[model samples]
Target: MIRLDVSRIKNVPGETLRLDLNFPMDPVQSQHGQVSFNSPLRLTGFLTNEGGKLKLTGCLEGEARIACGRCLDLFDLPLKAEMDEVYCSECREGQGPGGEWVLFRGDVLDVTAEVAKAVLSALPMKLLCREDCRGLCQRCGTNLNREACRCSTDDVDPRMEVLRKLLKDGN
Candidate 1:
């Protein structure tokens, strides 16, 4: 469903095209979220040919909901990614095999995986709603950012009792 047409530029070497593609993510991609998001994904990009090989360059813009690493809050984050890669008919499993320039042979090229790769690579290692988010309290499971809890604050090192008593007496 995400195929691109290229038969028109068979003989032309320097010819290029500006394509607007709408990519829908498979159901499997929704597993990344805490909740299910059964929405279709939209991605936009361009394809061009320079020298002998064809190149795919584009940007993906969308929104996805991910759980915050600290407060466990579910928030929507705007996703934007830019990528430039050469298209090859025969792809090697590993790098260093030397990528062979693929001649534009077919009428269409499926750019779904290419777009997916770009989006996946741009994901953050740790998702967060904001930088200064106060996480949930360990004792009462209260969101510290929202309100202060009545949980005991006596959980301190016994070695510092002398200092605690000194501070308590206003010494």
Candidate 2:
């Protein structure tokens, strides 16, 4: 878990703290799929105490392994994300710096959940091995990028059969 010791910073406003560390994280499962980090993630950033609120700004750098959305092949994906979060010492439930806030009663602030969220948000909507990946042939389940398949490419949807017949009859 990534945590920041803010016992000193809480009493001193305008104070800044520097952070640079590497830590291992568990795989994150989402609606899309599972994502696992290749190695320890490097976190670099600073935290500043502005009045009674603590503002954390940092960058997370790492590599993640994910399955390709098109070809179903597992590949390495580079991860780099910038994060900015705010914590309040006396914030009530559902109140925060920008409509969302973390409440802390002690000097230590755990940021594991926040970091995980940042990683999730940084993921691409569609993971591809390459920009122009041809993907697999739907009919024959063949990798089109490697070679051509024997499946006929002229197959039409059942819903379009009526329209196709009308056009063929010149109607």
Candidate 3:
């Protein structure tokens, strides 16, 4: 649980507090897959007390262990996620713990789940081992990065049979 004590600036209206937290984090599941944090995650930002609502604006920096989409190899990926979250201590009459505004009580604010969600959403769509990663062979199931495959490139689509026959006769 990532909890930050905001007792110093709780009652003070329009007070802005700077927060910097560095700690080791466990693996978390994202939309693509599970991402492991081998290095300490750095969360640095400022919290502004707007009336009774606290606005958190910060950036999370960490390194994640991601699998390559092409070759399926695990590699270290440096990640940075921007966070702009809001937590209300004194909520509105109709507002509860669901929606854009998150309801919190007391001095300590637990932002573990929120941080994980932000990092997951900021992940890249494609995870590649390298820029010029040679993927496995489709026919022989051989990894092209390690060695060349002996699969023939003469395979033709059935629809191109007429074209092949025309080429043979024209030649």
Would you list the C-alpha lDDT of every candidate in the order shown? 0.63, 0.81, 0.81
User: How do all the candidates rank in terms of TM-score, highest first?
Assistant: 2, 3, 1
Query: In model 1, which regions exceed 4 Å deviation?
Result: 27-42, 90-105, 146-148, 152-171
Q: What TM-score, to 2 decimals, does candidate 2 have? A: 0.79
lDDT of 3 at 79: 89
Model 2 per-residue lDDT at 100:
81
lDDT by residue for model 3 over 11-58, one digit each (tens)? Answer: 888998898999778788876578888888999999988886888999
Instruction: Provide TM-scores for the models.
Output: 0.65, 0.79, 0.79
Off by over 4 Å in 2: 145-149, 152-171
Q: Model 3 residue 29 lDDT?
A: 89
- lDDT for each residue of candidate 1 in 1-171, tens digit (9 for 90 to 100): 467787765346677888776656542243255422245556556676666456777787777667777777878777778867776543443432365333334677776666666667666876778877767766688887788876536676766766655653441
lDDT value for model 3: 0.81
Q: What TM-score, to 2 decimals, does candidate 1 have?
A: 0.65
